[model samples]
Target: MTHQVHLGIALERAGWHPAAWREPSAHARALTSPAYWRDLLRTADDAGLALATIEDALSLPDRFEPVDALRPGRVRGRLDAVLIASYAAPLTRRIGLIPTVTTTHTEPFHVATGIQTLDFASRGRAGVRLVAGASAAERANFGRRDIGVDVFPASGRVEDSPEILAAFREAGEFADVLARLWDSWQDDAIIRDLESGRFLDADRVHRIEFEGEFFSITGASIVPRSPQGRPLLTVLAHQTVPFRLAAEHADLVYVTPHDDADVVAIRDDLDAAADDLRRDREPLRVFADLLVLVEDTAVAARDASQRLDEWAGEPLTSDARVVVGTPADVVDAVRELAASGVDGVRLRPARQPADVVAIAEKVAPILRSAGVLREDADGASLRTRLGLTRPESRYVGEKVAL
Candidate 1:
């Protein structure tokens, strides 16, 4: 049987299109408010989507030129992604809350503890989308050395400067240490024996003595083992270095493939990387990311996207595939990609609430009828719902075969 097509929504404030904030349906000013996020997440929960990815950056959205900062109808600013996910966790029951955290400037120790807390808050439904790269402006905010985005090429081929490679290398190490820290506390470490007056087993908790080019850590995380041994680690990979990093660390990886041919090629690259991985783990779940504009019909959706671009005063662009169609058309496009071995697609709704609602009501049914989607809220953890097993801690030794 074909694998089920998993679904996730990329919850960008004001939606994917820049002009979406100007749309009547968009509450532009409420993008940072907790109430706004609760409502949006509730929509996903009510619709039974598999996951929701909240986007973030160290810097505000702006143009290269300073004057363009004041451009009207262009959305700008966002709340902290991790905080947003934490705020939404209680309001929604099942959708996985994966928030983007930049590995470039943030410390690994902080990232480890933060996501672990999010997992506890969400009861194992938390995932982290590790991002790399900090613009000069963003670096200025943190008083750190600037890491230029130019090192990452548009063609997905790696011809990077030492600085660029170092940035990705650091990101890879950050991901590695995060996993170790999460598993530093063995699942059986916490023992509440009132008579003995001992709460934890010292031997069960081990130090993660990790040393890398950019980071060095000896950690036994303060938090206990999260519900998912390791909250799902994921990365968005476009080039060789990032692909290798994703293959080495991520449980699920997101990619931007324009068509079936693109999907096949990228999947081949990722498969090769995974096959050569130093560690033994399950094959990576590769999800293609897309910007979707689903309206009453395909033509209307295209027209709407065109209008959004016109309003923004330039052609709207994105790293992911952009699909303009009705819910049925969107399903067809997803099916086409799935036939070429794509595990699933994470959609960035061109307009939020409405487009996402349409996906739940229309596209989900089509997928469910075809056995491409699981029935609503059927799993205990995000890992289970995605058909991933709860991984044993890396510190634990493998069982000896009989």
Candidate 2:
């Protein structure tokens, strides 16, 4: 197939594996250090990976569990994902830095400006993974909304839960507000004409008076028009509600497909959602999420995975499929995914630094050689590299109309 895969890595504190921090190569102690993040991102940047997504959440890791029932040995705590991405901006170039921004608790205005600032900091290589905060524990931190007693009722599918559906709906509106805010200032709004003694053209800025079910955001973004105009927006979707949200607002959507059938089914669902919504933008770019552990040999990789699972006192389980194998094995899996019509794969390294290093040094080369991975487009913005156009502001002529 001629379709080139967009490879991305998901960065967690130590790694996705609960016992990853126990690994010798894991930078457990340096989890909060900038140097650690710098090294990890530099590795991906040098390897020609398309993007790196920094995961975030309001509550501590494993907050879903009761305090007494919380697992003890797992890696806990995290620096702000946006700050981490911003810190890595000057440290590397090329790879897109997408930080998770929980929409449930954050103000849309803050979200827009913060990401716009990141776009400026990264020179256009910035994106955000918009996620909704679901945990009651997480909600307690903000105390802004009451999502009812049963966050995920035991009776129905978690995604079908009323509170969960409401959260996704709110998140969709949140995304809409962000888009409006990002476009409030026209690209040429800043004239910088010193002779005229004017910094900006008043007619070029428009106020977005948006009032939604969850949020009401007013006016232009505090930040200027960013390098990519509106930076890339992404969402991770596992169910119909979220798929609809992604279809409506995301430039890219990360999905978990356990098999070839799943890949096709999920793609169909996303397409159906976009069609149903009458989405006029480009079709959402689909990236399958995978928890990966790679080694020189298949046996060795499985052994490592088993060892990590043993350390954690349970086998590794994830919403995404877990792949434990050699580089060649990974290439084969990716080949299958590509044939199944996935635009890309975002691998969550089972062990930080170690698994990520292996992915960059080993798996990436084979994918490139096999023509599954795309060649690097040097000095391209994240949107350009992902083949997405830098969009024009939706409110371009609004001031004139008024």
Candidate 3:
């Protein structure tokens, strides 16, 4: 049997289509409100989606909708990925929640613990998609000295400059530290033997004294015993070093591709990296990221894309675009991608209601009927959903001489 592909939709309250907000089916205020997310999660759950990825960013919507005219960088957003998972936890029973977090602004200690909390809070249905801070704009938001949007922003700088490679290395190191710290507490540490008034077996907890060029964090999280142990470590890599980081640390990686050729090349890169790392990254699910704008008809969707581009004061993206199409068309693209070593596709619709509802109602069913999607959501936590087993902590029994 062919390995079945999974379907995941990134939620932004509205659907993924840019004109989706204008569509009668979309809800206006939900894009920036918690209630909006809750409603959508339920929609995905009802549609039986495998996962819902919530994007965490300081800036949002890029533009606005009549529903809720967002003054980009002004209107506060709904709760971020972790909180979204917590909010959706009780409402929907399945649907793995993967939230994107920037390793640049946050300390590994904080993220490591918070993700673990999600696992516990959501009953082991938490995953964090890690992305290196790429924009000077984003860096500025966090008050960090950042780089511009161009690839490897400082690649040719003659003076002291942080290149893209360095940024990824730093982010990789950050993930490394998070993994180590997560394992710093052993699984059996929670021996609540109240008879002796000892809540924890101290011998089970390990300390990680990780010191890298970028950072050093002492081991042992304030919160211990996460349900999934490591939850799910994922990184979206569009370049080399980040790709390598995914090979080393990420259980699931999201890759960007211009087309089929790009997808094949990335698959080859990951295969080579897996060989170098002596890790089985081959079956390491690579999910293609697409900014979608699905519509009832291709022509209408195309025109809508054009209109949205005009609104943004620029043309729709030339590359990495999953333009207007029907559910069958989207499935064809998804099937081709899966054959090219993509385990799935994560869609970011310029939307709130239409794209998401369509994905769940239309795309997911098409994928399922085509024998490509998971048949059911039972026995699926974020880890198992991505096919990763429990990870062994780097701090299990070693003491660094440093």
Candidate 4:
């Protein structure tokens, strides 16, 4: 297959737009249904998309707080992202399944093994999106420690307060621990030698003594080496700390750039951060996140967006760029971002199934025609597909070549 732009879809309950559920095609009550998630993954797989991210949080949807007194068609609840991915893994093929998880209140040991389990479940087509918790309500759900939202700044910069910097620093260390734990067991550790009566080589497993200001752990992960060796690490970031975290650990990062200049700036920052850290791994794959309202024609797409906005009684905006256009127009917009060195685009559909179908049936064909999308997944692991090598176990001593 020729070189092409990567494509992933961020799947949330109902859709991204607050008013999306008001759309005729929205499944307002199917947010927690296993069948709903399964069908969604199947649809994405059929489209030959690279991956799909299941959005999750520690708490209920804060957008609809006081859940009983919510809007008519708002999505209220969410199933566990990790569980959803695992449930749908066997039911789908090709597309990678990435679940969002908050690293703040969760254990790195649990995060490592959980994602490793996902990689096994999905046959190496698994990843996790690490997000730092930024809500007081979310903290209450954990009750683990007091992580105030004030720790994160309004500017998304780290140079301001020690608390914010500490949070990011903790996040960075957390990511490091996850990676180390993932490599704690060597690939050939599982001997399964019946004659020797050894299921694994004890020496192959190493302990990871990770001690940080926020969290500490001493032990290797309970889960064995997964199919991917180390599953892909992903983060969505808009600023320096997160960008640095992504550069240091993430195989892929989702960024939202407002314009070509923003794209250039973000890419430059990523490169600089990687260089500053002396990261020798492959360049981080940067995918732009866009909220897309796609239809057969640009006019229709605009109408759709406006109608959704009308339902919400206000104009809609987002942290990510929101594009309302035909499938071809959407492709053009993505190509423009790609020109600015973006590796791919992760489309957040404004409405489920309908907008997703537009992406798969319409936008994907256009990308394929332009030699920018592969016709099939080619049975490659998600990390392989993303051009990442199977990472060597850090626990293993380096073998010297004669």
Candidate with the greatest TM-score versus the true structure: 2
Query: Per-residue lDDT of 1-402 in model 2, one digit per residue for the tens?
Result: 466788999998899999999988887889999999999999999999999999998876463665345578977788999999999998897999999998877888988999999999999999999987667667667787676323456654646577777778888899998888888889999999999999989888888888878777666788988999989999999877788899889999999999977887888888899998835788788998988998998888888998998999999889998889998888787888888777889999989899889999999999998899987578899999888899999977777421
Could you tell me every candidate's TM-score relative to the true structure?
0.93, 0.96, 0.86, 0.93
- Model 4, 1-402: lDDT tens digits are 344688889998888888887788987777678998888888888888999998987766452154244445556667999999998887887899999988777888888898998888889899999886645666666676664564345665667756556667777788889888898888998899999899977788888877878777887889988999888889999888789888887889999998988998998899899998735788888999999988887778889888998888889888899889988878887778766767778999988878888888898888878987644446789988877789889878843221
Winner of 2 and 3 under TM-score: 2
Clash totals in order: 0, 0, 10, 0
Cα lDDT tens digits for candidate 3, 318-355: 23556467777777777777777677777776666667
Task: Check candidate 1 and list the clashing pairs.
Answer: none
Per-residue lDDT for 35 in model 4?
A: 90
Q: How far off is residue 265 in model 3, in Å?
A: 0.7
lDDT of model 3 at residue 142? 67
Global lDDT of model 2: 0.86
Q: What is the C-alpha lDDT of each candidate?
A: 0.82, 0.86, 0.71, 0.82
Rank order (by lDDT, best first): 2, 4, 1, 3
